[model samples]
Target: MSHKDTIAAIATPPGNGGVGIVRISGGQLESVARGLLGRDLPQPRIAQYSSFIDAHNNTIDTGLALYFPAPHSFTGENILELQAHGGAVILGLLLERALQLGCRQARAGEFSERAFLNGKLDLVQAEAIADLISSSSARGARAAQRSLSGVFSARVNALVAEITSIRVFVEAAIDFPEEEIDFLADSDIQQRLQQVIDDIETLIVEAHQGRLLRDGIELAIVGRPNAGKSSLLNALAGDELAIVTDIPGTTRDVVRQQILIDGLPVFVADTAGLRESEDVIEAEGVRRALQIQEKADLVLLVLDASTETPENLPVIPDPKRTIIVWNKQDLVAGEMPLAITKGLDSVIISIHNTSGLDVLKQKIRQHAGLNEASEGVFSARARHLDALHRSEKLCRHGLAQLQDFSAPELLAEDLRQAQQVLAEITGQFSSDDLLGEIFSSFCIGK
Candidate 1:
């Protein structure tokens, strides 16, 4: 818990700007400040415009220096901020001066890591800061903000408390043994377990939606050549990102466009026509299309309504996860066997006339399991999802042990393991390697 040494770095983004900031955090900030300012002016939270002199009392650069005392500042340690005119050289000079004063340069994400260590922010909040910074949509940003504000952590903590209460009762029954007979028969215990399961399921649904927001959905467009694949891509993206031509085999490679629909990031991949071909390039494209379909969250099956029915529509992976889009529907008069695979399958649309595109977009959102009308969702990484899944599985195992009236010790052991997995999600109990791996992903100076 006792972190040694001071870490310093230019906190602002790279490149020249009107102004830039260099930040330092740790124990030796006061001494480092005194050395650079040539005097002790550690007025916590007060800006002191001073010269950034070196150990030899030579001016490094003039800047406004501010200090934040421990337990109140970011990283939960003494922090120093040097705000200087935005110049790569000026910030570089300031950083060099700090390093000379025995302050090591800050590592990527170190500041957030320190915040986690000092209990200023939990693991979820720390990750949210990154998500907020890199959010692609307004909704995603808002979700990250809620997570950073501890909304997600609060919910997780409440669930953990609920689990703990159940665990305590189960363990107590094992120890007392006298109450064991009646305890196993109590319906209250079963009710509490069921309620907890319901809560976990709800969280899983919400978190999965949030995950889609963060990771976005991968959609692959497939059909025979001249099926209006490029046109559909251009229409959805609202730009001519992919080459659009009337030729049957115009697109020879997979063209990808990332666009936001209803504030959800969607990767629209326009692939070459899915069919046997003699051209080497077209063959490669076809192969790539199949591969993309395997991992795609949804497949936009574009069928040219102007032409004959597609004799061989590509076999979609996870049919439940696909939406068969009948494009160029305007060419045909009315619906003709529009069912792609039944009610759970497809939708008809006219990309040429821009008809039914709204319906198509809505369907995409639904396929992603996203509630587009959602007021808010907490951003969660795949790692958090993994942890939650493992915790849920173990909890269910514990529930089974209880229902069967098996050995109480078996139930207790499962609960203990489940608790540890949940604890890891919030950083309640963490390993050094995990800490290192998480923080190292951040850019220097956080």
Candidate 2:
């Protein structure tokens, strides 16, 4: 499945460093090597000390040249690696020289696509590589590492096997005519179908947790203009990101800050105060705050802890996950005192005094399912979840068909499509279109 393009790229980041690498892969490795090496290249998979010369046959820079032969190399093609001194000017010169020697610059994610096509990695593993690169939490990183090692793929494969076996049995029963036992009435068939359903249920739970690890939790901060909304942001961010002022309406627009809490990424957005305003600008700001709150994973409805109650909150609908925060206790009693009977199962805190922030953190951790993410959590993507949902619906439909119509052909057909849907999780049933979409998300040079 490998392509024929001679792709090349700067393997290291774009900057000056101790060393840089220029990676190349194609079907014409020998010709490219001979043209640059000024002599016959060494056999595949062996590194040789060599000097890179220009078109005019003058010395450029000397480095180790390693050649990996086709079918055994990454991308299942001929591969070459040139180690050179790290310098922007130096690396740019090398890249320009290679283009002059019949190599083309690779597009984003081409190398990883090649690896996927060559069977070095399935789609799940390829995606896990991206997850590992962008992991925000230690828990996230560990789960992604497990996914890259095929933990997630193995589970998918197991489910696919179970589905295939069930389909085979249904198909066989359909082929046999005049049997005394009806396939649908058999207790064995019912038991097997139920088992598949149970397995899917378990996977969906784990996959949902994994999705959170990859996408992170979105948090919204809403309150009156001066109820320490900005201060809460500044304190959690460890930087003066939001403008803190006693003046109301100091922040008319949402101020977004990305903060890591115990290694978990929380995108805390400090929104405009939710209150009636005479100014046109303040009215628009409040409207925008309502919009962001709708999509927040957790909403921190901030109120003045000194004397404010839940009734002080704006007329926003209660989100599925809400962590009520009573801020500005520093001005009230110098310490936050929690009273559960105040109507909100919330936490009280002082942004300036830094009291009760720990309680807020604990609440956030619990709301995000991080409190239960220590074990059995694997990295998953939205696409994987969608596929599972599709398979799940089809399984339900097939079960109904089996019990009602006694249609073995219909049951077999559903199971077949179900297997394909499940296989997409591990990329066993991927189309070129799906592959293109998947690989296009990666950075060039992988």
Candidate 3:
């Protein structure tokens, strides 16, 4: 895990700030530090005010230099950090001076990658660092922090241990057939297998919630012309984001607005009114609206309560995924229409007066599967969800084989495959390409 060459980069964000940092990590940090500081390295883990000198022995910048000796640094190598005034020119000069001292620029996520390679962090923890940095919501950030603290990893490891114990027992029974233990027929073995399946199922549900937190749900608004589609977008966004007019087909393109519904991020897309139009642009807009509707996690079907009914509306491809919103309640006289209020998934609201908006927000949160209980969940990526799903499927298949056909060998193989799939989450069985892909997405100097 030891690197031969030194790597350096401007650790802080690019811009003017109160202070900036140039970090270097590798075996040659001692020489790098001495060359830049123009003096002997400071005591390990202590910050010393020093002058950053160039190769010509001219002072490039005055900064605080902190040194961390080998085996005690973030990358598990000798590390040096130079904190200088937050000026682009000064930071560039410091970085250039370090490069002159035989240090190369670090790539995107190289610091975290080195940490993972040196056994300082597991795959989940390393990825959690990136997730924490890129999180858009406060709840998402907290969830990522929990994952970084090893809450998620500990759970995965416990499951791995349980599966490993079962595999060992099954393999032993296969190897020692004359023991007369009847391992396959034992009720204890069956119970253990069932418990493992149950655990996997539970984890899958939690992971799905975590993934939703990490990547918020997409909601598409669709309906015929002048059905308050644009009005609803502006109302949800709490501003005039989309143009509203009495004329139909005013919005010829999709208008997107990202809003937080009860701490849960909801990407709301207001699409063009669905209708047959002779105008070329409107027809294209209608086509794009349909495309967005198909890909959305949920579709809000806006209806003009003043006139339109469910029977006259366009057929929804999936009624379960569609929420019927009765808009213009202010224009309607007397009680709400039976067609709009009859359905459990329907909500009556007036975009002009902002009535029933709270109920609509709650419905959005409910449909997104996020609630107060999700506060304790950890952040997870789509890839992690995919792995968990595969592992769970394998475990269920193994359980079925053992229970119905009494095929111990097939069951053992299924368990092994499940174990391997789960191992990928923690990098125990991850491929090199997968590692590269994961780290490549991280920001530089992470």
Model 3: colliding residue pairs: none
For model 2 the local lDDT of residue 228 reads: 84
Q: Mark the regions of model 3 whose C-alpha exceeds 4 Å error after superposition.
A: 340-344
Tens digit per residue, CA lDDT, model 2, 201-314: 888878888887788789999877788888889888889998888788888889998887765678999988888899999999999888889888888888776766546645
lDDT value, candidate 1, whole model = 0.83
* Model 1 alpha-carbon miss at residue 268, Å: 2.2
Measured with C-alpha atoms, the lDDT of residue 151 in candidate 1 is 81
Query: Which pairs, if any, clash in model 1?
Result: 108-443
How many pairs in model 1 have backbone atoms within 3 A of each other, for residues 3 or more apart or on separate chains, i.e. clashes? 1
lDDT by residue (3-74, candidate 3, tens digit) is 577889898999999999999998887688778987888889888999999889999888899998878888
What are the lDDT scores of the predictions, listed in order?
A: 0.83, 0.82, 0.87
Off by over 4 Å in 1: 54-58, 179-181, 334-344
Error of 3 at 296 (Å): 0.5
Indicate the TM-score of model 2. 0.92
